[model samples]
Target: MTVLILSVFVLVYLGMAIGRFPGLQIDRTGIALLGAVILALAGAIPGEALATAIDYPTLFILLGLMILSAQFELAGFYGWCAVRLAQAALSPVALLALVVAVGGGLSAVLANDVVVFAMTPLLCAGLVARGLDARPYLIALAGAANAGSAATIIGNPQNILIGQLGHLDFWPFLAACAVPAVLAMVCVFATVAFIWRGRLELADASPLPLSPPDLDLWHLKKALLATLVLLVFFATPLPQEEGVLAVAAAMLISRRFASRRMLGLVDWHLLVLFAALFVVTAALARTGLPAAMVATLANSGWAPDRLSVLAPLSLVASNTIGNVPAVLLLMQVWPSPPEGALYALAVLSTLSGNLLLLGSLANLIVVERAAASGVTLGFWEHAKCGVPMTLSSIALAIGWLWAMGHVGW
Candidate 1:
């Protein structure tokens, strides 16, 4: 049973790192689901224990946030923001700064992946229409999304999980990460601007038609109201999952958008991914090998409980298996981690994901959308900006956390 569980876990994480099997169409979500299924069939995790293995609170919170973001999407709010950014009569460098600013700011509150998904194509079309190179802007958009999402727990999937599991306060989490996130956005603008210098204009490009969704002022008003209510809940003693779920339910009572459409827009793929990882990790924990290994590692001065160790580990783990999965895996192995360590983990894992194109789902979404828009944003092209931006931002995060006495060496 132990061997079987370990084998399944290894195969699933390998799929995560490589993104897929050589000839299989299965993605990280599928890999995780399959691992859980394998464990259940082999009796590594009994059907009765399945319920205990999954964390439903985390899923509910994710679903609620997705619904909130979907409201913005259906109202054409995200597209409108992108169009405005593109249509602004700013210079090349100024335009880059605006892209980073808008992308980061929106991502700090909404789901970063969804924000990038809605903005990428429209932003690309607008830039190309203006005869400007869209490559740098797209890269900055992805990096900004990653960096900005670090500011709040609800900003990204990994941070959401960390916040829920760690029982982190919303305001304090924001206070801890806001500065690093802001500096990271600056890094995004600087790195992209420096690398794409003198290459901002495209002479032969013609104006491409923008296709943003028609603005629904009424629905946008409702979204804003719901967002304010959510903030109120966060400030109070009310449970986050319950409050957000309530807000999502109220949004569903709308006459403009159908419940089916709103729910469909939610990333069920990501939700399933989180559930599947929870099951897989739980099954492995039943083997007791993880606790033993952690004990040995802790005694050897190599535990992920300190700033120095966690920073590098987060960088490698986040860039490899991805930040969400890396955080889930670490939570399983690291028993009863300190609150400060949790903050460090959340900030470091998120910032480190900006190191490469394959680092975050937001980055991949931007790249894929750009490719569809005839803008080639290759791996090395992104790395040129991502590498430096990530390194600098990560350094800033570490310094801030350490100086503030949030974490120890």
Candidate 2:
């Protein structure tokens, strides 16, 4: 049973590393689900244990946010924002800054994936209508969303999981991460703008047509109100997870939107991924491999006591298996890292997503949307901005963390 669990864990991570089995139909989520089943079937973990390993608070939060985002999408809120921003007639630099600012700001409040999903089409359409090169704006959108999400506990899945698991406070975590997130956004704007400066000119001066359609005012109002209430709750002394769940329930009960539609928008696959990882990691933890590995590193004078080593490792691990899973694995070994190491880990892991096209889901969405719209944003093109953006943002985070003495090492 132990060998079976370990093998399943290895195969799952390997699939994550390679993204998929060559010529086979499998993805990270599928691989993770399979691993969980294998572990259960092999008697490494019982079904009840597997169920217990799943973090319902985090899952509920993600589900609720997705529903809220879907409601906004149905109301055409994202389209409206994009059109308004694009119509400002700003210069290329100003437009780039606006994209990053809006994308980042929204992402800090809403789910990063939802923000990217809604923003991508609008951005692509707006740029195409303006006859402007969409690559820089698209890349900035992806990078900004990922970076912006680092600011708050509920901003992204990884942050949500980290906050829930680490018991990090909402406002304090934001305070710790806000500066770096802002700096990262600025860096994202500058990097993309600088690289694509010459390509920002509009080839056509035609104004894009906006046809008014029937708006779902009630649904939009309900989602907006629930979101605002959730924010207020987060800002208060209430239990974070419970408050979020309450807001979600209120939204779910409202007749303004169908519960079925809202529920369907939830990313069950992502939740499954987290649950499976929890079980697999739990099995690995049972083997005491993490302690042994940490011991080996400690003996070699490579302990996580140094921010220099810790920060870079966090970045690399994040880009490798994504920020959420990376945080889960790292937290197991270094449960209570330095005072602000958790926040630093959240920020760096998110910012590191810009290092490569495949570094994060947000980047992949942008690339896929671009491809569908006859605009190709290959990995190399993305890396041109991703590499620099990632490096600069990470450097800024490390400097801030060190200067503030947030991390003793």
Candidate 3:
């Protein structure tokens, strides 16, 4: 049973590496679901074990945040903000900075994925109208969204999982991550500005078409009010995950928008993937392989010494299997890392998402949307910004962590 579970785990992550299973129509979500079922069927995990393995607190927090984000989206707040940014009479360089700042800032509060989905089209349309190259702005928006989300516990799916699993408090985690996140955003702006400068200048500055009028003001106001209330709760010393989530659920119920429509905005596929991944990874945790692996490393005189290897390893694993699963796996081996190492690990893993187009879902969404707009950001184009942004952010993170004595080495 242990061998079977281990095999399933390896195969599932291998699928993640390849971005999908070969010769199958399955995506990451589908592969995860299949892996979970295989573990159950193979007797590695019984139905009860599987049920217990799912992290309901994490799931509830994620669902609540998604609902809140959906309310904002349905009210067209993101679109309105994007349009306003577009109409600002700044040069392309200034405009890029604005987009990155605003995009990144919002991502800290809302899910990065939803922010990208809502903002990408408006940005693309705005660039096309102004004859400015849209590619760099689109890339900046995606990269900055990922960078910004690293700052807060509720910012991204991976962070949410880490916070729930590690029981990290919101404010302390924010303090640890804020520096790295800020540095990452600056890196994003500089990298994109350099790459797109010439193209932006050469393009004609024709007047753009008017943005579609803002959505219902009343609904937007209500969503804004709920969001502010949630922020106040988060800012206070109150236990954030459940408290803020209850606020979200309340907002969802009070909506003039139909319940079906609100629920439809939820990323059911993503939620399913999280639940399945919980079972699959939990099964692997029970297999004892992680403990054996750790012992082997310690015996080989290769025990991780915090600043020297673990930090870089965290970035690599995050890029490979994603931050959530990588952090989950790492926690089993290094259960009680030094004071701030867990938080540092979280920051490093997340900021590394900018290293490649496939490193984060936010990047993929930007590329996909760009392609749909007849402007594709190929792998190399993305790496131009991703590499520098990732390197700089990691460097800054290491410096901060070391200064704070978070790393044992």
lDDT of each: 0.90, 0.81, 0.81
Weakest ten-residue segment in model 2 by summed lDDT: 208-217
> What TM-score does each of the candidates earn?
0.97, 0.95, 0.94
User: Model 2, residue 305: displacement in angstroms?
Assistant: 4.9
Q: Model 2: per-residue lDDT, tens digit, 1-409? A: 6677678888888888778889989898888888877777777876667677677777777777777787777777777777666666788789889999999999999998888877677677777877788888899999999999989988898888888778777788888999999999999999998888788887887886643235678877877898898888778878766777787787677655688877776777878888778877877776777888888987998877567777788778777877777877777666466657787778878888889987788888888877876778888888999999999998998888778877755
Please name the candidate that would achieve the greatest lDDT relative to the true structure. 1
Colliding pairs, model 1: none
lDDT of 1: 0.90
In model 1, the worst 10-residue window by lDDT is 201-210
Clash numbers, per candidate? 0, 1, 0
In model 2, how large is the Cα lDDT of residue 396? Answer: 91
Model 1 lDDT tens row, 287-398: 9999999999999998888998999999999889999999999997789888888989988999999999888999999999889989999999888889999999999899
RMSD score of candidate 3 (Å): 2.0
